[model samples]
Target: MADIAQEAGFRKNQKLKDALLQHKALSRQGFSERLFGLLFSGLVYPQIWEDPEVDMIAMELSDQHSIVTIGSGGCNMLAYLSRSPKKIDVVDLNPHHVALNRLKLAAFRHLPGHGDVVRHFGMDGIRTNSKSYDAFIAPNLDAATRAYWDKRSIAGRRRIEVFDRNIYKTGLLGRFIGAGHLIARLHGIDLTQMAEAKSLREQRQFFDARIAPLFDRPLIRWITSRKSSLFGLGIPPQQYDELASLASDGSIAPVLRQRLEKLACHFPLRDNYFAWQAFARRYPKPEEGTLPTYLKAENYRAIRDNAERVTVHHASFTELLAQKAAGSVDRYVLLDAQDWMNDEQLNDVWSEITRTAAPGARVIFRTAAEKSVLDGRLSPALLDQWSYLEERSSELNLEDRSAIYGGFHIYVKKA
Candidate 1:
């Protein structure tokens, strides 16, 4: 009965379909969109790729602020709880993401200690995690969320059992990383060597010696040139075009190579868990490297105490903001979702954002290209209401540990 209910929920995700399907079904672009929609309809990000540390600084988050943000993988929202925000309305088109967000909130509230929280989310492939879920976390979840996790996956194990053996290895992004590892292995390169580098110099040497050559390989260039190859990264056709246009040769290989180079060389591996995930496929052990803000031991007590402030909504960010009163929200974290929007969609979301923004409210988002996506697409009136912090955005974009996005933008609502 739970499985039936879950299947119904997955099939009925009209909002997701509406967001992804812009072209006719028979066209190649349309087919790729549908395929991405299908893959994204399930769990796409086991952990979101954006840097929450940068987001916090961009928003100037405070206890008095009310925030509305897209909830991808739920990590950043939980991290925001550390700030003791007055409210966090987390909206997502994906029901699985909604469930995952709710589950994390419940875990923070119910799980006994910081170690237990780390065990559940930070570590990968622990057989005891399901036991902990059944005993501690499951009972605290809402009925729908509980049913969603209780439902079995295609592997004949309950969805909750993913924690029993590397939950991070189960999602679309996880499989994408795994595929990348396999490809590297086939070419006689060990991707994990990047994680072992002790300094920036070592990191750069490893990238030049081992990783840079992989991008120039004929097979790799061909695979990356296809739009479908990036579905695992949650990049849509429009964003893929933007990414390819950045390279002089108009191939995604050089763009991807540059991004991976930043990921490998810009920060010490000992401090970047994002690097750990990219190269090691798992977060570094506690004394080895850093974890996301939400998973850090020091933030656990605050996150647990403030977990109730977060409310996960299974809907679009625009729809959710439209329902709020004017001047109600103080902060907005859009992630890289704006890269997926068409002109109308961009205008619609920004309209609501401008309408609902409080005095001096801030909005932050990322783009696949090295400029704000809203430059000309949003109506002039709406665009004029916000001040783009271009210099600060560029500075922080470099500081972003994830290093996946081409640009990070900050817009402050004109008072």
Candidate 2:
């Protein structure tokens, strides 16, 4: 059996070593936690849940900024590249994510133009994707990344074949979204209808009539009640508990219902690729104007030109920050990784963050719960060094098209 560190990508960080080991041990105490851990170790998220549009606004990223971020799906990393940051150092515990990030970077660098890259990633059933990979992307990939995609699956097809097939349906989140469609089908509800909604009223009516009813289906209730079942949504046991705690009846379904409603009704389908993926299981049509910020036709040149600025690593955020000189990094995007940590782990990461953050540096993150965990968790002195942009965070969270997270946070280093 693989050790927790090996599977989870723990290394050389004194602060995270024992803490992660203990967390792993606790995860092993229950079957659900262990199963979710395994799922997490694999490809969990095909795309990030946080909204990069809100992130961009909150960070005010520019050519002068250097960013350090957790690379989940590498979507936001590419999104940040559009601003032409000095550099983006991406770290993730999953080796699979590291490879995916590397592959995306290579594609951006070597693909002939914007349309090729968009069709390769944004659409399914493109026969030329594999050919494009062989001709352009494969040669540029690192040894490990190349080997990962080269390995064949049980279907006797290389995993890289997913690009030609449907890359969105290939990861844990993709599979989870696919499962939701299957469940909806069993109940005689076609979620794809939600995508056809012309207005917010129509979206809500569709949800109330079709998608919303599925939540009450006995099968859905049973599956959702089991903590193991949500791994595909990238909700670890800890986050599941946080979400459940927020529900009055201690059921996650209600919280999820509200979020799904926001996803379907709060934004137009033409501009929300997240909804396109959830309901239609693919990004919006290229002409639909709803692609991710990085995938936009106008921004493609900037993204391709700035591809070399990113560096991917399979390491902990704290470990990478410790290696950097003090006051070097200008932006930090932690996603929801901090919710998986205890207070000690939180303090340790914040210590490195404070140490490495340049003057006027900004940090952004999201939480599974409505409030920031750092409020009562970190020491007064450490917390005092930064100012929490509560009003701004709330405002931006409203604009976050992803609509999945409970809160979005922004903290700026004090002058």
Candidate 3:
């Protein structure tokens, strides 16, 4: 919104780095489920990685290239297959994310047809998607998963009803908007479109003139500036550093507000599919929407086309790399995963990458800082064999939807 929030006056701040260092040094760092508790405690899930729609437009993917990604919430994998990659191999250490990925694949492969599929997932405007749980998905899940889905909420509503009541509740970005809406209501701002406004220009103007100013408030800004406040958006320990670095003087709230406002306020409500998922909690009607990648009617056929290229293992990144042939992978989407690793661990990941990267292999990753986390920590010889495109890196970052990642980087293996 404001020249990409990287204006000259904004100094790259390191307080988040200082804060993370202390957090990392603590005993039993990142081990407790309590940390993840912040992620799912509310009725909603946090979001990272903007929607894949815009970024996928840039890839110009072919039938030949294979993809490997972390299966965070599984939205993007289905989105990628919409373009028909040869294979999409998603890996995640978190069982919840893996289960969700599996569920999405299972739904696509097995769900009866587009309208029913859309109604099952796209209902409740996405905010009330839990209703579809009772109607469609819950019955389909195995006993354990069904039990989890059928669990009751404190409000006494079955979690399954959340589909009808909360399609917008699925991921982090939606929750952030919900939180923002709550905060806005507390301040007497009505963000709903039906309340007023006749034209799109009036809508954006209203946001610019009335709604956006609240971000300048001391309390809201202060609360959002802290590193912990962002865990709700699934800003794992690794991405916070880069997110904090985005602001001048380490004030991240303004930048976050700008990008998020873009997600919320910039486009028409119905046409904005991400917002449908985030705000209304439903997929647009067939004429009103283009469903996310995994939800498409064509996905089963698309993913099934290249299914053979992938191999799934119940393992971590390092463990899985150990089993792969050298120089075999082409694209790697490590979504905020390296933050879990310290120096030694990162080196081991890099060693595997160096050994496994084919000539001209492109490795892309998002991080919490503008600087490469692997730079100083990696062996000089290993780092020297690659090309880093700083300017091109900036371009690739342009239309990313999740509005959460701070830095986008790409490294190419030399021939």
**Candidates' RMSD to native:** 2.1, 2.9, 8.4
Which whole-number lDDT from 0 to 100 does residue 90 have in model 3? Answer: 80
Judging by lDDT against the true structure, name the best candidate. 1
Q: TM-scores across all candidates?
A: 0.97, 0.93, 0.76
Cα miss at 257, model 3 (Å)? Answer: 2.5
Clashing pairs in 1: 125-166
What shift in Å separates residue 137 of candidate 3 from its native position after superposition? 6.9
Ranking under TM-score, best-scoring first? 1, 2, 3
- Go through the candidates in order and give each one's C-alpha lDDT: 0.90, 0.85, 0.59
What digit string (tens of lDDT, one per residue) describes model 1 on residues 220-307?
9999989999988889898998998897775699999999999999998888889999999888997688888999988999999999
Candidate no. 3 TM-score: 0.76
Off by over 4 Å in 1: 1-11
User: Which candidate has the highest TM-score of all?
Assistant: 1
List where candidate 2 sits over 4 angstroms from the true fold. 1-30, 287-289
Lowest lDDT sum, 10 consecutive residues, model 2, at: 13-22
